[model samples]
Target: MPRLKAEDAERREAAGHGPDFLEALARGLAVLQAFGPERRQMTLAETARVVDLPRATVRRALHTLVTLGHVESDGRLFRLTPRVLRLASGYLGANGLSAILQPRCERLSAEVGAPCSAAVLDGGDIVFIAYGQPARLLNLTTMVGLRLPAFCTALGRVLLAGLPEAEMDAVLAQHPPFAVTPQTELDPLRIRKRIAKARSDGFALVDQEAEQGFRSLAVPLRRHDGRVVAALNIGMHSERGTATVLRDSYLPLLRAQATDLAPQLL
Candidate 1:
């Protein structure tokens, strides 16, 4: 596949006429964007290739970012430093969606005696934004900001079901809906049918799809305008209950919390 180049050129052209827009600053941001969970450490040439810029240009940007303490290098590979987290901190800290949803997640967790989370679909994944868990629940391997596959996760299915049919088809086509577990729906048509069921039912119950021993129940979290902006879900240990118990017993609790969280999305 071609390297990710579409956004870099677009951002530069959009910045062309802005009086205060800095090309160096934009390139520096691009260099930072080149790094992610999969590419945490990259050499200058690799960064240049990923950002679709010349090696010298990326090197210069990396040097300036190193001076600013946003990036660090040990003479081989460059990696972002903790200072870069400040940029994300400002956005997540802003009073609104997360602030409102997290408390509801906490209350929902307490009421159900389990872990609960709210996530929004981004690209082919769902990024966790808010969470809550009971004390007795074992520590989880996941945290806020973690991204999970959209096709296999209950949260992702509920969010995907909210999209218009054409938009949903487009997304499924791009992503291929690859199976994450043996039970996952690998066929795009089958996955579309599953999403349709979720749309009609107003929720999704994924049974051992994302993981072997876990299942999930999820519902759409809508805005005041009745647009689903995110999904709220409960992860369960499959051994604890059957799918019928998961839906009939615990699904209502999730739906109720989802109702409370919907209006806050505005």
Candidate 2:
């Protein structure tokens, strides 16, 4: 596919500008996102290519990020530093859902002997804000601000299932499927069917989709106004539990947590 032109992207952003708009902030965020797994240590040219910004623009943004200690460059390669976590930490600290859901997730993890997490849908992915794990040795290293595909994760599916059908379709249309594992659903029709089932059942179960041998079950966390603002999930190895176990044992606990958390979210 052809790369998005820098001028075109700038034009699109200019069209959206308002009196209170911060275009510089938007461009900075775009630069940060450009340094993902594939393009981790980008030079100025590569950063511009990935972010669809002019090389000069990206150079300035990198300099600003470096000055702020959010990014570090070793002469040629540039990458984000741990200071970027501060930004996500500030957001999570200010958000009510993370505070309320943290204790509930811990309780659920203790009760179920599995890892539990609460995540919010962000664009085409889910971002885990709170998590708990009973087994300290379990190698699930995901932390707050880690992003994963929405189609393959139980939390993502639950969030997507809660959306209106039209909105769900729009999101799916934008994310043409990429296989993360053999069990990952790629067909749009099949994904729609799975989402429909989740909507009706009030939960979502994903097995070996995001990663090999990983299984998870999730329920939507609805607010007082009945809008699903997040998803609660318990993750474990598929060999450790069956779908029936998830439905019979974990589902009720997750539902109860979600019910208790609904009132606490703003």
Candidate 3:
């Protein structure tokens, strides 16, 4: 086993306590997550810097991952392999929410003449679990596992509103809002108020906050126990008119779908 540096060990201990914490497993996962679209391939030294771990530690993790077929390496450069998708597949298969929602999302997208998606909050981001698009080309393309900022998207607002106040506050504190677009509200107080409004209104409408020329509306999807587990949203071009028109036209549809699917989820 490669020895973790003193500072790295201290940071890991602080982040994950208890004797049951497997430091090696945590380090491996961290190393895996360090790879992203922007960083498709990297050298051992580059990966070590990104993960803030010693080169030896990262090298061992990469070796293990390569042996397991989750990573590919060519002497000097390392990259994740398609086999890594099995990890995400396992979660989706076990949860089954994506499977149940995809067909409904497609139907909704066709009816609305726009894109429809379902997402769940993951850390400071919202991960799209299911998505559907109209036959016509749209500026935005969403797919399963696409991650977006939770502070700026209607889907994110609704999902964040579903969290308890304390939990929501903790998340906001941890990931203070950043500007995804000029329309995105960077003020934490205003963002909190927006989330609060979503909680009370049962739906959220965002105009051009997530992307230029794009607008979206979202509503919470609850489980059988009335606990919100995810959010459903529709995205369209900003030319669709003002926020009021979006709310009036799409809010009811979103709410209806959410309600219809609530009994099926859990």
* lDDT winner: 3
Off by over 4 Å in 2: 1-10, 13-23, 138-142
lDDT of 2 by residue, 14-91 (tens): 787644556678899999878766776888888898888788878889999999999999988899998987888899
Q: TM-score for every candidate vs. truth?
A: 0.82, 0.89, 0.92
* Model 3: per-residue Cα lDDT over 225-246, one tens digit each: 9888999999878897777888
- Clash total of candidate 2: 0
Return the TM-score for candidate 2, rounded to 2 decimals.
0.89
- Residues 142-226, model 1: lDDT tens digits: 4677788898889999899998878877877778766678898788778878888999999999999998989899999888898
How badly does each model clash, as a count of residue pairs?
A: 0, 0, 0
Steric clash pairs (candidate 3): none
Q: Weakest 10 consecutive residues, lDDT, candidate 1?
A: 1-10
Which of 1 and 2 is the better model by TM-score? 2
Better of 2 and 3 by TM-score: 3
Candidate 3 Cα misplacement greater than 4 A, ranges? 1-13, 138-142
